[model samples]
Target: MSSTHNQEKLKELLTQYYLNTNEKMVFLNKKGQVIALNEAAEEVFSEDNDYSQMTHAICRRCEGYSNEFDLMSCENCFLEALEVGNGSFQVFMRTKDDKIEPFTASYEVIDKTKEIYAFTLHNVSPQIERQDRRYQRLMMQKTISAQENERKRISRELHDGIVQELINVDVELRLLKYQQDKDELIDNSKRIEGLMSRLIDDVRNLSVELRPSSLDDLGLDAAFRSYFKQFEKNYGMHIVYHTDFSSQRFDSEIETVIYRVVQEAMFNALKYAQVDTVYISLYQGEASIIAEVSDQGIGFKLGDKAKGTGLGLFGMNERAELVNGSVNIDSQVGRGTIVTLEVPITDKR
Candidate 1:
């Protein structure tokens, strides 16, 4: 066929494909004015009865600009970048249903002599929602795993520590009954008394580990002070602590959740940060309580694969959520890490 006839045939084929495709497509001029749109684009604007009168209308459906520029401004728009052949980027736009949704957009100069550009959009909201659901399910599983591990630890402590001590005392008492000399019997009785004292200490330690009695009796402030002191003594790590809500009290559930999250954050720093000193601060907001723990030690990337099982961070988040709270973690690879927990003072139950 002749060159003119071949060009006409190619245009017809392109027009047929554009009309039959499901994706939204439109043509615009260099000044960002709409020239023409395909049937899929027409249906989207039809929901608002805007298709017939949309000639040369500036596309205001953009929800926000990309992160590289002002979030909601039109400056440096993708259309402007078409002069340099910038082809594709992601954007959020307001749909006919009045919802701001994400779309993968592609822009290209279809007519170089006239400076006309073609823009195509593909909806991506369903894929984003599916990923969020998967993350939430994984977090729930991690929380359950952490609880089970804690239960096993407590059980092992009782069986191996206290129960074995009791057996030793029983044997010592039986030996006392078989002693012939009075002096020998007295020595055996003294040894039994020593074992009983050690057994009592073990029980108290276990009770504190499960749930400190001071937390219920004195409140969060007093409990934290005592816990921090013990932590320093045990691990030889110093914690610079400060608090403004010294005598204030909150709902029991809120107090417990905050305490547990802070405890876990501190443990994570001790195990991974490898720092000698840490800082902790607590204060009350208008309707919430905020606690922060930070350490100047080795940190890790936000989305990088974790070195450990990572259940500690998951457990901290789960505990906070139990009381209508949130946990925020910030870290840099060579800098440090900070964990903040905020819980509303309202009744969560």
Candidate 2:
């Protein structure tokens, strides 16, 4: 073939394939009525379409835009508000399946003389679903990591702290068997008895740290009281606590998740906030349970390098999410840090 013929053939193929892809291209008049559309749009929207539906001045399948007030609302509708050429947003639209899904939409006046525009859509719901899946995987991985780390710490504590003391007591008891002095034997026996009491206390403390008995038997209100006393004694720091909550019980899952998140928040403050005192507020809102942990200390900026594993914050957020809740952290360089958690009361049942 001649060179000119080859160029014409290339253009033909380009025209043939360009309009048949996954993208939906729609041409609209000034009235927002669909004037023309590509093969892809036709394939996607043809099943439920009728003659009047096609010709009537209707927004081409657009539902609404997501705003701060609502996820999808006709408030400040895009049809009336799409500017001349600077219109681009995430829009919800009804697809071929008659299901609403999100899409990246762009509107531009392609022909100013006729006041005609081109509206395009690229479905974003698939991408959003993929992102959600990835986040869930990350959450699961981190949860497992946290569990293993806790188990290892507990195992090491048992082997080193209590087990070592027990071994020393065992040696003393065996030596007592060979001792000739009655008073020396009695003294050693009493010493061994003291060691056994301490060992029992250590095991009980470990068990409580793993899962506070008050959390299950009583409620979060009681659990926090017990936890804070131990926290102050163990870390030499005070928690100025206030509560507007009572002893009413919640779903075990909700109570447990909130308890763990609060525990982690306080632990983070103790480890990094560089303060002698922390403030905590627990309350029951109209539809949610809320907790706030605050500290006036040498605060660090967010997105800066974390002093610790950095997974603590993410883990807290993830755990809160599991119970239909949220965790918000606010901090500044020299001011202070506050961690807030909210769980909906709908989950209380």
Candidate 3:
């Protein structure tokens, strides 16, 4: 074949590919006027029937969000930013059938002489929904695992700590019954009393660890203050605690979720961070209650293998989601770690 004929055939092949591709492709001028569009784009904005009539500023079919802002909004409109050469962005747009959807979009200058640009969009709503569903399932599994583990822990505490102590006390009492000397009998009685006291304290501590009654009786602030004091004494770590809610109360579920997440974060810091001091802040935002636990200690890489079971972080996320909340963990090696939990609160009192 002649070179001229081969060139013509190649042009025809390119035209066919452009017209048949599923991706929505459009060519626009510097003025944001639609210069031309492929068959996929034609179907998306079929209301116009004529491509020449479609301009980005007035297109109704593309109503959605770009750069976390409504696409129609004048501020940070991705189309407008094309004149200044911006990067690819995620966009959610209403389809021709009126269903809102997500798309990954890219725009680039195609003809500098004419100030023309090519805009491409790839539909990603299905992939996003699938990922979200998978995440929710994983979270549910983690939550169930955490509950089971906690039950096992409480069972162990009752069986090993309290029950064993009671058995020892029983043996001591049996020895007291056989004692002949009054002084020895008195010493045995004192030993049994001390054992009983220690057992009582252990049971109380176990109960608190399972679920602190103060959480339900006095609200989150009181529970946190009491817990922090005990934590400091146990770990010899100094905690700087601050809170804005004096006596303000929230839905029980929200309060519990926030308190538990913060508590878990604090424990993680103490176990891993090697820091002597930690900071905890609790406050109410406009629509959410926020708890932040931070430490200026040795932090680990965010995605590296965990030193511990790693369920603490997962449980925090699961609990936060139960209350329509979120947990964010930020850490860098040798810098620090900050765990923040934000839960939406509907103030009941």
Candidate 4:
């Protein structure tokens, strides 16, 4: 009798320390009823709540558990599948604040004869969020790389093969003008030459629009200059360009992302902003490259109804994520708009 009493005292003393710890520990019976819980667990779940609500504390908090086939499924519950031993799995639970979130849970049989089990929950929401961001960044990089490579190949084909062929046709049409003395033939030759000239210009413009060779050969600084020249001619809206980034080269992917983001910002301003002029700034920060596009045009509320399909801003953000970068847009109704992109410098300094 003294031995059993001493053992019970020892258990009480040890539980006193465990009950006060930060780790949430809960006990369950074989029927999945809550038997006991530590102080930490009490904060996460209710111990004294009755089954008048047709639920136990564990069932009230637990939404579902993860299995091999499903992210969160209630079909095969962890309580039923859990053997009389140790096991770990992800479980989604409703917290005290009533938010459904993920928790890394472990279950084990604490007393085999009594069929009592221990269940512990460690919140893993933050870790899952970080992991998701990492995966998105990686996927964005690969997708952009593939797109740029294909664009480069198609651009070269149009500029070299198709443009050259069209130019030769222009020369032939011009030669036909002098070869014929008949008024009818001369008129036909003149019209054909005019058509060929326009066609050649269109092809050249399309090639450059697809992918500028200057971007590949010279770098972002030169490429932006060339693109802006075309931009001004096409839109008649001037861009007051400012740059601290000279001919400095970066990784091809970074350059592409920057150029594409800047290009989209300008187009968004042109399409929506009721202004004729925009300001673009490109520079290198401590260990990052930054670009800003601003305009004193008619800006709209950020969360107001979108002017277009709403995919333009989304695409810019997705592109920035490729380099572990970010895009921030600031705008206010009746004021102006500013879009900024910042990407870290990785190699190719």
- lDDT score at residue 74, model 1, on the 0-100 scale: 63
Clashes of each: 0, 0, 0, 0
Candidate 2 lDDT, tens digit per residue, 90-179? 877776777888877777877999988777777888799999999888878877887899899999999999899889888988888898
C-alpha root-mean-square deviation, candidate 1:
4.7
Give per-residue CA lDDT, model 4, range 140-223, as digits (tens): 776687578768977777787677767777777667756646886767776777767767766666767778899999999899
Model 2 lowest lDDT segment of ten = 50-59
Stretches of candidate 3 above 4 Å error? 1-3, 49-51, 57-59, 62-75, 83-89, 284-288, 301-311, 321-332, 343-345
lDDT of 3: 0.82
Best candidate, TM-score = 3
State each model's CA lDDT, in order.
Answer: 0.81, 0.81, 0.82, 0.81
lDDT of 3 by residue, 254-309 (tens): 98898889889988998999999999999998999999999999998977987766
Estimate the overall C-alpha local distance difference test score of candidate 4. 0.81
Candidate 1 residue-wise lDDT, 1-349, digit = tens: 8999999999999889899987889777767666778778753444345433554343567764454423544666655555423645667877767778777778788788998877787777788899889988887787788778878988888899999999999999988889999998998899999999999988877777679998888889899998888789779999999999777777889989988888888999999999999899999888889999999999989988766778888778878989889999999987999999999888533
lDDT of model 2 at position 82: 63
User: Candidate 4 deviates by what RMSD?
Assistant: 14.9
Runs in model 1 with CA error above 4 Å? Answer: 1-10, 26-35, 42-44, 51-102, 105-119, 140-145, 179-190, 285-288, 318-326, 333-335, 344-349
